[model samples]
Target: MPNGQGGYQPIFILSEGTRRQRGHEAQESNIQAAKTIGEAVRSTLGPRGMDKMLVDSLGDVIITNDGATIMDEMDIEHPAAKMIAEVAKTQEDEVGDGTTTAVVLAAKLLEEAGELLDQSIHPTVIASGYGMAAAKAQEFLNDMAVSISIDDEEQLKQVAKTAMTGKKVEANVPVLAGLAVKAVKQVAEETEEGYEVDLDNISIEKQVGEGVDNTFMVTGIILDKERVHPGMPKSVENAKIALINAAMEVKETESDSEIRVSSPEELQKFLDQEENEFREMVAKIKEIGANVVICQKGIDDMAQHFLSKEGIFAIRRAKKSDMKKLARATGGKIITDIEDMTIDDLGKAGLVEERKISGENMIFVEECENPKAVSVLVRGGTEHIVEEAKRSFEDAVSVVAKSIESGKIVAGGGATEVELSMKISDYADSIGGKEALAVRAFANAVESIARSLAENAGLDTIDTIVELRAKHEEDGAVYGLDAHDGEVKDMMSEGVVEPLLVKTQAVSSGSEAAVMVLRIDDVIASKGNEVGEGGGPEGMPGGMY
Candidate 1:
């Protein structure tokens, strides 16, 4: 190569292996990545949706139709695909449902944006149109929300059932949905805004070897443990329990110290003093009228003997998290020191017993007067079945919790989405400009949610959308595809409902993801670094920018 002077030199701005894409090429690459991810999980959208079996390099398997799970499991490499997956994560973290709707809508937004790009439309114009549509879509969502309350058990159950529908838990939906609602209700408290449910208060414990029918909810905390000593009573009636974080063993000095024993008398005196310390700890527990002691730390052998002798059923080494749940469920304060324990610190339960299940002993703490923390013992015949059922049950719990918190719900089965499309499209028409095309494109992207639901249900996507549009035109916009009947019907009346929060989150995240992809006109990617002899990426000798 030669310059005007017959000599040439080129400057290197980036690393030797760095790859950079500009303009339409970068946009197309990003959009394609998003679309590919969207297509990957699009089929798993509704009750009739298909499940994905993801196996990792270690051969561990996960079979689920959960959009969040699928996205999290996929080993995605593309930056755009990862960003798209983040939408599903945000939807799940925010609302606990409608993850599929979020990703599908984002993909369609980019798909529509791609078409507008072919028409020489500016990316900024498309992004501006999408922003307007997203904001308008949220406004439309508020109009469609119907109030929900704790007293509305039937509606709450319906919400739970809707969340559990597509998971492989059809036969047990009734029982599980009931438990989900009941758990949410039990933990729900009146707040200035409305009902507040802390999902952490509702604990789910899974056990295998029993049929799903045996699954039940406990009104109190359930510990996967047994009494510490064989001599301890297996059950305590009218149990007065103490929740302790401190170990029952004799306290050691803060720094290492040793006693230089000169004779057997000194050693014997030391043994007697240690025994008295153990005796005092157990005596303190019994003196406080606590018949059941749940210790977070170890119980010394001598302390265990004394507790057994005193007829106190003690559980050793309880998890700290479980200790918190017990404190919530029992309405008792957790004491760090045994000396601080008093009669008033004792938590009451009608019965605390250990039961054998699957040949293992698990303690059941039940019949609390009013437990703030509750447990759902998920039982199933196999590991996979139990895992799947637990996931489904938890999703139901989250949905019920969110519904009660928001006090609002919207029609499901794609009804809300189609309605949103109709409303936003009308809004788009009033603003007739280049941006309006992008706004209209946003409306179509939202409609893709319904189309995905229809296609997943094995219905003809085009025909379903046509019928839904027709229904929205003449009848109320609540009419959506009824996958079971293959007809468009009112989702609200049919009891296909979802929390209003999920819908708004899906719209917000989907549009944001699409806009993020569109605004990026250039992408510079660092090449995969080669492993150096020192086991670090070779190209990262200096800080990676």
Candidate 2:
């Protein structure tokens, strides 16, 4: 394609309809998209924040103010906006809260970076400054964090309550918070690195009958199923439970075989042998002094009849996961062989009862004095409310778990953000270079969190910021925006606290996302075929700008 002259002629290096955007055009478009995403979730920040009602293409609806939920529900198409949304996801995954704060901070950072770009500052410089500020911001958060322990019930409840402050279940926060702290403490185990909380060990079940206030924690696992046979006991007290993974039925031969039974006597003998096998299995279970049988496999009809005749409460085909949780909750081991069953292998439970709930039968294994696994039953007036309450309870549980694992917490209600802002600005001034501007910009961006809190609460954003800054300067880092009263107060004294890891992770994740988005200077998108090339809408790569 080279011309005869010294230079080469133009060649169609890209596809015929391909389009691209580079340099400032691409950067500005990406920044705008990210900022739009941030604004979408900004109003859903604090206790006074409004919830978003997201409807999918299938007409399924979700109502919540949780940042992660909003991000997940929104069908975002823009790549840059998707990246911003991931900031919230990362925050949610790492600290279990503060997703809104993280995304808002990242959006604000990009907004500030756009202004710097107008002043001839390079994207690299802004990213570098953000990196420095993020590191220092974490340091400030650590310095301000108050030490907590697994035994700090009051503070731990505060953590859970703070996490559930703005959710639909806010009215039941105190009770749910107590349950969250208790559940997390129960499942928490000490590892070599630190205390670890396996959230899976804490199961949350929702039953829509009563109001959210009826939610309570169970010391043992709850099975959604009831007794396998009606003749079995409806309730068992002082129960000796057997955890079985094997089927209480005769095993079929591995190879297919044909049995020729010409006489009725031969058939009767075969039936009698099967009946004896079932009786033997039941005999072994009863011989172990077990009154409650939780099986992971099927129980033959004859076996069920024999167990019911013995007055044992038996539930067959229990989920394997439920079986494991049952083992942990009951301090029992799952036995695979009937011959190995013994009294020593039995688990103790004060009560095992089948209760009728909302016209359905449910099994409750309650009153395990030292059970490791637990369940939280959430009740609400409607299905939607119950679903929302479950989300809120899960958030509370996660936050409490994080607090226990980290053993550090800080004042909430924008207190940590305000303090980090002041500290970061101080560090910016000390740096004294082009990067200092970026660092200062990062500090200003961090203040967006407080502004968002005030804005969501229907307060004057500028006035609230000024007052918060003045108070932080005068009182200390603990002074923060009390959105409830539109006043700057000491968050620590007010019992408004969050896990320190939440704030630190928000800053780090937000900064990383913002920096990554800012560093982009080009966008190349491949458009898929809308229809056949010969008909309908055309398919081609289009420049976002």
The C-alpha lDDT values of all candidates are 0.87, 0.87
**Candidate 2, clashing residue pairs?**
none
lDDT per residue (tens digit) for residues 80-160 in model 1: 777899999999888888898899999899999999999999999999999988988888899889998789999999999
How close is every model to the real structure, measured as TM-score? 0.94, 0.92
Candidate 2: tens digits of C-alpha lDDT, residues 35-106: 777888899999999999988889999889999989988876667777888998998888778899899999
lDDT of 2: 0.87
Number of the top-ranking candidate, with TM-score as the measure: 1
